[model samples]
Target: MLSSHCLNDDPWNKFPFTGFVAMISAVLTLMVDSITTSVFSRSGKEEPHADVASAYTPDQEMGRSHHGDHGLNLSDDKELGSTLQLLRYRVIAIVLELGIVVHSIVIGVSVGATNNTCTIKGLIAALCFHQMFEGMGLGGCILQAKYEWVKKAVMAFFFAVTTPFGVVLGMALSKTYKENSPDSLITVGLLNASSGGLLIYMSLVDLLAADFMGQKMQQSIKLQLKSYAAVLLGSGGMAVLAKWT
Candidate 1:
């Protein structure tokens, strides 16, 4: 197995295989829900209107026509919707970090399990920069959410210790660590696939979709172009980093 780590001989990676499987299952569930909602919404079909008149009141109708007319509108209804959306973004950010934490831990575990000084040197620097940028993104979302101090502190704590916790866990399991086993490959592949799905969904749905489909980005072709360029630059930089990882 001429793979990423020494061929099928490392057990440290295998130790987290069960956790990877569970996370993948959870991600798949969310992906399926997102897909179903998207498809159902696009068809403009809802369960046969159970008493349409009762469902939509005169005030509701007026709100739909007026308040919901524009994303930028400052009506009570629109404000509520926007507030909910902002909260949703923060929740997604928190969950995204949770998913990211799993991988981060695995990376830490690998680093801790190894005695290679050269690898450790690069890992420390790369990880520091990676965490910094990820924190910036998460912080922006949190600031927008306007959560209470305690909640913010809890989220921050989770992000701060995730990798270190993984490192410590890996150190504990180093005795059983075998990095190149067949089990490890399947596990890593699945974890990567799961994380990839969650990230893609969050990026497209919560972040890009909300803004890109909103009045602001939709109205400005130049802004849209610049945003696309920015996404490309960020993605390209991450891809380059993968070469080293």
Candidate 2:
């Protein structure tokens, strides 16, 4: 994709391609996270458990409600906060999945549209390893979300199909689509840039921040260091793949 775009005589010179698409992606992710958080927050607060409510007498319930309005017990509050945090994490995982799907599709289409066998071989190798690691990360997030089996299957199916679907679309359009064309450059460049930004934001802010700052990591310095080292190694490996693809 970069090679194709470069053939168009530096599209970046005329357009602030990177910054524009990145800003759009950042805004999109922020909006999604904000809306999801607000909706979850309101839903979490408004629902009351009927079983728990039934356990209390009217007078005791009233007193307890009053106390809850003012303050909650430390342990209770901590438990409630943990539940809410998990809920938020599930939402973030969904959003992250969406960004990754978009990226996967774009890359798949680009790879499928190419005619060079040499390039195809290299891309196949790079993408195989790329998807393997990427899948592990995404699978971890989905597992953490604790989705039902059916929902998990559905998400997995969608993730699995996106690239193939893109490939199909690219093959269908291969006769007419010119990757180096001005139109293709603009469209593909923007899509790639936006997806890049979205993935970066989701990785750092949603995935990394939540785990690294969570209680388990915070309590263990050695674990934190090991995790950071793992992150760097994984990131560097992906960066190396970028050179080939």
- The best candidate by TM-score is 2
Provide the TM-score for each candidate, comma-separated. 0.66, 0.81
lDDT of candidate model 1 versus the reference: 0.64
The pairs that clash in candidate 2 are none
Where model 1 places Cα greater than 4 Å from the true spot, the runs are: 1-76
Tens-place lDDT digits, model 2, residues 129-149? 877877887898888766667
For each candidate in the order shown, give its overall lDDT on alpha carbons: 0.64, 0.77
lDDT of 1 by residue, 1-245 (tens): 22346435465345555455555656774775466445533332342222123334579767655753456445644444444454455556666666667667766776776667887887787788777877886777666655666777887888889889878876787677655555655565566556655666666666678778999899999999999999899888777776676
Summed over model 1, clashes come to 12
Model 2 score (lDDT): 0.77
